[model samples]
Target: APDSPRALNGISLTIPDGQFLGIIGPNGSGKSTFGLCLSCLLRPSRGKIEVDGLDTSTPEKYWQIHKNVGMIFQNPDNQLVSTTVERELAFGLENLGFPSSEIQDRVDKALVQFDLTKYRKHAPHRLSGGQKQRLAIASVITMQPGLLICDEPTALLDPRSRAETLDLLYELHRGHNITVVYITQFPSEVLHMDRVIIMHRGAIVEDSNPRGVLSDIDLLERFNLDLPPTVKLADALRRRDVPLPAGIVEQEDLIQEMRDIPRGAPPGDHPESESARPDPTETVMELVDVDYTYSKDLPVSTPALHDVSMQITPGSFVGLVGSNGSGKSTLMQHLNGLLTPDSGRVLIEGEDLASKETDLTSIRQRVGLIFQFPEAQLFEETVFDDVAFGPRNLGMEGDELTDRVHDALQQVRLDPEYFSHRIPFNLSGGEKRRVAFAGILAMKPRYLVLDEPTAGLDAEGTHQIEDILTRFRDSGGTVLLVSHDMDLVATLADKVLVLD
Candidate 1:
């Protein structure tokens, strides 16, 4: 372990006061480790991190340094220490020995600003992944840290929530003069930053303003970093001999570029467009006037869905887009029989899911639902056992069961021969996501639904999901995906359902 490569090598840098900085790179690039060092959570192996002339390694100055630089981790569930949302938000203030009145005031302000006031009394664990992420950010900002180091703080949020959070951070930097260091894998998130650092294999390779960092398309591709959607669109248009201007990275530029093209056939419709056409098959599943509400007895009971109806066609790819609390996740749960409607019925292949005689096991075997976090669904000791659990439930056994498990793992780009015997908990985040995907695919479900499938995935992991989704549709499987990635939706989905 001591001989392993360093996580942060020659990563010397400086951040001025009130600067909005962004750090991005591929997986295992030491971005998170750098943030930890800045906040004094981890001491640098060789160099040092200083916050406001205070060395992070100084033992006596540790508490003061931590107060000066607040950090919000990628996983909100891990950051929340209290049972209720309000308690969690107030924990940091209480630790700083703030007065009761001030703590209440700060907590109230955070609750309203983050749109979390309605669920202040709800358990943190009960909140959606996005909501939990919001709570984590709200909790840290209430501490009034001068330098806030965020590690993928908005990774689990919906598109609207993610944009709103970034906008809030920008306002905090401009108005409160807080130095913000934001770490993300999404290229578009850094477009507005005052400065951006590109990290690779634990080293800083590029340091420049937002335009300089995003304009170099070849550099990002060499490092396997993803291009922003608008950048990709501009590049593609340029390759078509349109010769559009360089440095185009916004949606408005693309709209203007399209307007100059004279609107021939509405774009994307060519003579050889049969392969790209969407042909819907017979209905596989349908929801009729569904209604659902959570915590009916509580004082803050909220309706999740209201008279929502939708149909899932066989072999068709569907994308569900929405903001947090817009019932996207709640609606996805109904498809797999995890939540039943209050008044309406769910039809699986024209058969009523509400019928007492219906078999849930058979339905679940035909429909697979992947949660936002893969760890929630992985419980078996070994990877092989975890993937085989679903198939075995359907009475599969012997060599037949093993083949299904192996093939599914291969579909997710995991070599079953090497990964089968490994412990599920020992796998990395990306590996765990692939394993979880394999577990559901092992069942050979006709329909698959995923919630934010690529929330924290890198470019490679994102490509793997895209390939799998395409192959699934080509083989007559139905996929309904909920995601914040508009680019992915445009590329994969034939039809889209907007929730809010």
Candidate 2:
């Protein structure tokens, strides 16, 4: 028998009925595994899990326990198996032997509830990552289990969608008497939980009320987790001896506290002459009067982009932000010549992307676009082959191929020796995402366009990506990043394009 790694190590926790619990931790900290164990999807190596007085370990009680528990996985692709959105929503109901009328009614309600009516007949595999995530949550919640476990269900969602999903979870817990276990990386998402549990290395590191949990800054730092924006800024003011009171975690309170401080240079006051700006002559890519449509069949045709125009300057970081279906991903695809415009011009280095002589292959090589879902980028048998596939096509061999693959893995924090021969499909969701990015990095693109680049990354992994993007930009490369994290975009983007 193969010696598989232990997902949960001596883990124990008890949940009271009708309580809303929030679990927070860094990636690979056993959060997802813990969720799986509690939901009866994965039996623990040594511990027992029970739900609603039924033991999950007992085969006879399996259905009884499964009926009381529902789980939404972190990876949307892994959870979606039905051909269409509607079918996926009805899957659990059908498995529970619900009548046809009941299944249809629940599926119909879910379609409207999650804004999925438009995609009722669309295949889950063909949907965008954010869409699939929404579908996954909708499907599980429709089953109406007594205990719900969600593993980063909103990680791939845009800001508005994430808010809606969280609101729905709160409604289920507060209105429907559901015991909710919400697992997330974002500190703000867990601020309202009745109880908060911080996990590290398959063990509970901290268990306390949300108020007490949020007040401890040092604990968060030790675990490498990001603090809520207001908490972080409040800590900053305290560090500078500004006399700001401690434990201020809300934006309004933090702002009021700043107002009480003696008048001084405004928060961001700086010399106008030294302000940040990039040279206009450094434009590396440009889009003018672009328009694109998908699924030309009259019934399914959808216009993704319209009269969209933008320019990217070398050494500049650009953020593309919008709602879930607001053309952000479609625009990123255009940057790398993946999709030709229905009209207008995409100019990269002064060459028209639509021209037959422009060599689209070379343009794709120069402009790397990582999809919101990383699974699309992986196909080779091993991790090493996947990363090396890019350079290998460019005639790289021997030492050069070895160095490129190794460096790419290291850049993404994956141990080269340990992961080089491993199958890409066996890695965790976050690990798969990183390996995909590394594959693109090996190509050494001059202009990079990433869609939802930090979706599945943890606090530390996100920082590593930021560092890599900054280094690339500082080295005369241009990056057009598409992300829904407003704070991240505001902090790193030299320019922002907001689509309605």
Candidate 3:
């Protein structure tokens, strides 16, 4: 029995039919592994996994359990295998031996449900992060499973897309009464769940109603989970002797509570130490007259960056955020010479990045660019080899390469000895990300550019990443982070960049 390696470690929980449950934890806390076990992706090392009165361990029941439970993985790209959006959804239904007419009917219904009818012929690869995420969900929906388990489904999506996915999930549960088990790292997302299961170090730390669980600031802090902004703002007001209504989790509720409270004199009118509040003049990175377009003659071509100018100065952690089609990815690709501007120029360190044959290698050496879902870039046979890929390519060999690889692994908190020989495919989602970060860190670039670096991490993994970025900045390294996690930006960034 393979009980010792990937054991569940006394996890005992139950979800009744048609109930919605949320699983939360830091990275490697067994949240995803537990979900995978439930979905039959990984056979449990120990313990029982059952669904709809069927034991998962029995061979005959495996097919039955799988037929009733559909799982959507954390990464959109990994789960997606079809070329066109429509075909992707249809493949699952067709494989189940559904009649041709029924298969087509289900596919049409799913497309409408996820609002992907317009993109029926679109390739899954070309769709934006949010669109890809929705397509994955659509494929699962077409299967018509009684139980739906989503592992951080919105991790890579923009704010609007994340919101839309959440809305769709709620609708699926409400209208169809499908049993749903959702996992997420965002504190606000957990606030709406009917039930919450918190995991810590591979065990259930707490399981209760959202309000009861979230109100315990001490427990959440101990687990490195951030309090929702509304709760934090309320706590700040409470510290200042301002009374607020209980159970407020959203800005609207806080606004309502503020209206009910006695009107205090405005800060300018009051003697509340206005001298302490600093003006917002800090800048970290700046771009001027940036002009970029993917193609010149294509009728569908549009400028990815057009006369765009912005500033983010030293020690100012900024977030670049936008919707799916808003060109956020294209804009970032230019930061490290992954893409060049069609016209105009970009400057870093007062040196032009768009000038003729700009020393791109040096530019890249100075700025570490981590792509979206960077974990997928891992191709080496061992973890050490994967992390050492970048530095080795940079001409570091022998002892120097070894030292950089070790240091980078430690920076991401991955155990060097245990992970050195481990294949990247065998690592968990969170571990793979840290490995990706280690690869970039091995280069020791002064300015780090991350694109959705924490895309699929849970609360614990997100915390680890936030700590890593903060430490990088404190050490005098600048970071140009591209992410859709606004809450993360609000908590860690000194500035915010909204791409149109």
Question: How are the candidates ranked when ordered by lDDT, highest leading?
Answer: 1, 2, 3
- What is candidate 2's lDDT per residue for 66-157, written digit by digit as tens? 88889998778888999878999999999999999999999999999899999887878767677888999999988999999988888888
Per-candidate Cα lDDT values, in order, are 0.87, 0.85, 0.80
Could you report the Cα RMSD, in angstroms, for every candidate shown? 2.8, 2.8, 4.1
Global CA lDDT computed for model 2:
0.85
TM-score (all chains, Cα) for each model: 0.91, 0.91, 0.84
lDDT of 3 by residue, 1-500 (tens): 44445435788898988888988777667888888888877776567888888877778888888888899987788888988889999888877889999988999998898888877876787676777888998899888889999998888788777888889888889999999999887767877778998887688989899877777777777887778778878887776778775567778889988999878663333454333224445544457787776545654344567888877566556688887756777777777777777776667666678677668788887778888778888999999999999889878899988889999999989889888889998887778988998998888888887788877666667878999998898787877778887778877776678888
Q: Please give the range of 10 consecutive residues that has the lowest summed lDDT in model 2.
A: 268-277
Whole-structure CA lDDT of model 3:
0.80
* Leading candidate by lDDT: 1
Off-target runs (Cα >4 Å) in candidate 1 are 3-5, 250-272, 275-281, 379-381, 392-397, 423-426
TM-score of 3: 0.84
